[model samples]
Structure formats: structure tokens, C-alpha cells
Target: MNLRQLEILAAVVRTHSTIAAAQDLGMSQPAVSNSIKSAEASLGFLLFERVNNRLIPTPEAQVLLADAEHLFLMRDAVMQTASYLKAGRKGSIRVAATAELSESLMPQLISRFLQNHLGVDVSLETHRLDTVLNYVETGVSDIGFAMEPYPRPTLDQTPLATLDMVCAFSAKSELGRLQFVTPVDIDQMPMLKAGSGSRINKLIEEAFQKSRVAFNPSVDVRFMNVASYCVEQGVGVAIIDELTASCRPHTAMRTLPFRPRVQITLAAVSSNSRPQQRLVKSLVKYAREEISQRLRQVSKERSLKGT
Candidate 1:
């Protein structure tokens, strides 16, 4: 019914515990409970189900929580609009990114953008690919940086860069002697799986599935960084993203192209409904230019090596 109650409900959903939400809100547990109770009474339904003191938000609560988030963001937008009016060029751009972008590109792009647009504030939030897309869809972020193929009906996507996943090995490994890793070699070697859940692995899975060859994900890791670490420890070789392989902290490792398959893409997206803001436009332009240059440089290196 009120902003305070809506905020408390949203917090409870986010933290999944009343105690945690209370701590986060810097309020007493009793006060937080009272706010939720008041809100539920006003709505005439139970918003959350309690199981062992943990607040499991109901499906209806999920809708309300989403609405609450939108309302909160709308409030900020109003204030930002006022600031923009007063200062002419003062505002902020917020971006949500998945691993491919957050790994390094977003930070590098931000650094470059700030040099030219010093008056604009910038912030970034990293999340799963789906989560980042939703942030853009909801206008929670001015832009979303993610690895595609993403399922987005209401957003406009622009290709920022294309990424390739290649076999990486210690220089001492036999595979390191080969110019490229062939499909038959992958079948024999203990192929380091990037886990079935990774954004980049979706394409890899599709390719392997079509060929009727199993990926053989031995260790199911939750993070790409962990997979890289495992590869460094000689646990297994990794078919990691080009950006990941290029920046990986391993002097002894060499990345070779996967012979017949393996590729991913990085894309920048923004909601189609929201008209472009100056900061968002500037960021997209900067990212496109920088990423294109990097891609061209890599292509040239590959061409030279072909000779």
C-alpha cells in the first residue's frame, strides 16, 4: 500500500529471509515484520509462504515484487530527469552485463567513455545472461551486455564482438604442438567442459548434439574463472572464450582454434520502448569502435600467422 511496505516486501523477496532483509534495511526485525503484515492486510492476501522461517515468495508476490522494483526505478528516473534539466549534461548510465562483457570489455569501454563524457556518472551490474536481458527490458539498465543467442523480443541488439572458444593447453601438452585442435582429437582427449550452463557452451552443446557426440562434462563448474583455474592446474584442457583465453594468467598455456566448430558472440542491447539517452548512445558508440578495432587486430594476427 505504501512505499515503505512495498520496499520491505521487495527486500524480503530479494534476501529470502526477514532477518536478512531487516539487516539490509537497517531496521529492527519486528518493524520489518510489521511492515509486511500491514502490506498483506491491505492487499487482503498472503504474499509469502513461510517454511522454516524463510520467506518463500508466492507467484503473486513475484509479480508484486517486480512491480515494486519498477516503481522504485521510476522514482529514480524522475529525479535524474530533474537533474538533467538543471545541469544540461549531468546524468548517469547504468548497464547490466553477463560474463563475456563483464570479463573485461565493459570496464575497458567505461574507462574510454569517461574520458570524453566526464560529466556522466556510470555504474555496472553483472548478472546471468537472462537476468541482464531482463534488466534492459525493464529499463533497470540503460544497456545490457551479454553473450548471445539471447531470447529477447522487446530489445534491440547490436553486435559488439564475436568470440571463439578454443582449446587451451600447457605448452608441454601434446595438443599444444598442433596448429589447430581437430574434431577427432577432441573425441580422444579428456575434453575440458565449460559446463552445460555457461552462455558460451550453449552453441558448443548444439554443435556436439547435432554431431551425436557427448560433451562429457566431467566437472560441472559454476564459474568460467573456476574452469580456467582447473585448466591451469592441469586438471583438463578448457574450451574457453577467446577473451578469457587471451587474458588468462598462464604463461605456459597456448590457445589453438577448434578445427570444425566453436564460436560465441557478444552483443549490446537496449529496450526498444525507451528512447536513447546521450550516455547510452555514447557508450554504444565507444564499445562498437573499440571492439571492432580489437577484432580487426586479432584477425590480422591470425592472417599473418597463416602465412
Candidate 2:
């Protein structure tokens, strides 16, 4: 029988009377009696019998009562879980981010997101920028954080923030002696850069070209954090994004503003093929706010230092 009929059967069984069942269920006695009659017709059996003017459940009705109670319990649980998800308090999110974002901002971003949504479980992975895009496009990840992702029809990009490209070097180096660095300033120095075809590398190339300086890097790494680490070891000066530069591997690593102000947009990438879930949207919102707040703190610290 239908859920409404099962509900009426259970209520009538519990109360042992149509009037009492109707009162308990907020239904009329005639309506409850009619529902029982309909259920009996559908099942081709008598669910109740009149004995001494009392409604007594038959053996078949008794058998269904236990299962009906279990089904009701399951229904209630499903509804409660739905409520939790709708409120953005329950669910799991699988996230993939490039090495720079994962190393620099993702730890605090995840911590703050979990603090706000205590019931959400987050799985984070670090990949190269290209792999991050692939993970999202291939449905291997729910969300991706990348810098200046190229346009793709299969992927939807949401701009989170615009960050400057900075010059990172060892504090003991001569480049750190300058207030601000330019393409001409470190054109001939041992230079570290991202992979040759990357967006940052293209921007660095253009900047050096505009300044009439050579754009040769002694080391071309896949991740900005790796470049930042190399700069920490005094291997070479790195032209990397602001986020990686902020995550100094050692106190001796220093960052300076690169002249001409190369800027890149950090984007939240997701598959356009998959429908965005409420929990994923919540996580993105949290990421945006967390990044903005952290950047503000970084700016304040830099201002205090007069850099």
C-alpha cells in the first residue's frame, strides 16, 4: 500500500480505534476509516475486523506494522540529512589545488572552512596547474584552485582574487638591497622562473622584453613554491606569484615588488558538466573570504614594514 495508507494502518493499530487514530493523526474519523478500507482493497485482505465493537488488527496487518515503523524511521533520517545539506552543515568536498595555493593558503583556508562548517569533510590534494585543470575537467575533483587558468568550454572559472607577481630572493643577496626590483635590475642575474609555457612565465617574458632585457631563467620549475624554496637556498632569484613569495621557506628569503606590476587572477575552477552542489559553493565562498582576509593582513604587515 501507499505511504499514507501505511501511516493510517500504523496509527489505527497503535490507538485501537478509528476516532482515537484520527485524533492522533489530525484527520477525521471517516477519512481514517476510508483510508483503511482503501488499503484493504489494494492489499486484497482484511487489515482490521470488528470484535465487540472494537477494531482489532488482523495477523497480516500486524506483520506489516513492524516494517512500516522501520520505513518511517528511514524516511525521517533522510529528511534530516537533507536539511543538514541544505543548510551547508553536512557533506564532503574533494578539492584539488596547484602547489603554490596548496602550500601557501590552502591549509588555513581548510581550517577556517571546517571551523564554520563542522559537519563537512574536506579532502585536499596538490597537483601541478595543468593537472588541477585536468582533475576538475575529468570529474576527479569537485573544485580546483589555480592561477590564471586559460579559457575552456568544459571548465567554468570563477575569479577569486588578483595577486601581483613579485621578485623573491635571499635577504643576503644584492637584489634585496633595492627598494623595488625590475626586469632590468635582475636581467643578468641567475634567474628562476615557472615552466616556460606557463602564464607567469609569459608575463615575465613580456616584462623583460618591454624593458629591453634578456628573459633567460637559470632554472625553470613547475611550481612557484619550488622556485620560492630555491630562492631561499640562494640558488637564484625567482619571479613568482605573491602567494608563494608570502610563504617564505626561511626568514632569510625576501620579496620585493616587481616593476610594471604584473598581476594574475586566482580562479576557482569546476567542471561545467557537473552541477555545482551547495556544499561546494559554500566552500568556494569560504575560500574567497579567507583569501581576501589573509591578503589584507599581508598588506598591513607589508605597509608597517614600509615595503
The candidate that wins on lDDT is 2
What TM-scores do the predictions have? 0.78, 0.69
Worst 10 residues of 1 by lDDT: 187-196
Give all candidate RMSDs, comma-separated. 4.1, 17.6
Worst 10 residues of 2 by lDDT: 73-82
True-structure RMSD for candidate 2: 17.6
Model 2 CA deviation exceeding 4 Å by range: 1-90
Tens-digit lDDT track of model 2 for 205-284:
88888989988888888888888888878898988877777764468788888987899999999999989998789889
* True-vs-predicted CA distance for residue 190, candidate 1, Å: 3.7
Clashes of each: 0, 0
- Indicate the residue-level lDDT of 119 in model 2: 72
